[model samples]
Target: MYIVILNLTDKKADAPAHMADHNAWIAQGFEDGVFLVVGSLKPQGGGAILAVAEDITDLEARVAADPFVSKGIATPHIQQIAPARTDARLSFLKDVA
Candidate 1:
């Protein structure tokens, strides 16, 4: 799994121009069964996406394709996590092993 952080490099006000494409990109992630969660970074600084991929390289390439990154509106920071434990409700994550 990966924690993908999108930190705004430009003004949040400039986001609207690329918002549609950005949203479409996110929607595609969900359709592809990669994105587990997607939401803002609080205070509206940017956004974050919880996703699953075969490897970090794949995830990085995926992140690179985001409109926010390609359009220079944001920078992506990706963290790879190997879950050793999880709540009962999230036991499914153990399958990633």
Candidate 2:
């Protein structure tokens, strides 16, 4: 599993120009089953994504492909997680870790 943090950059205001394409990228993540959850970072600073994937390298490439990251609207920091334990509802993630 991975946690992708998209922290807003000084160019945040330029985000509107690429909003549609960014949204399309997000939709593709869901469509491909990589994104488990996608939501804002609160106070509208930026966003975050919870992704289930086999490789951190692959996830890095996917994040790079995001319009927000590609266009400098946001900077991405990806955290690779190895789940040693989880609540029963999230047991599936343990196997992946």
Model 2 residue 6 lDDT?
A: 99
Tens-place lDDT per residue, model 2, 1-97, is: 8999999999999999999999999999999999989999988789999998878888999999999999999999999888897899989888863
How do the residues 1-97 of candidate 1 rate in per-residue lDDT, one tens digit apiece?
8899999995556789989999999999999999999999888689999899987888888899988898888999998888989999999987862
Top TM-score prediction, candidate number? 1
Per-model TM against the reference = 0.92, 0.91
Misplaced by over 4 Å in model 1 are: none
Model 1 Cα shift for residue 19 (angstroms): 0.5
Collision count for each candidate, in order = 0, 0
- Overall lDDT per candidate, in order of appearance: 0.89, 0.92
lDDT of model 2, residue 61: 94
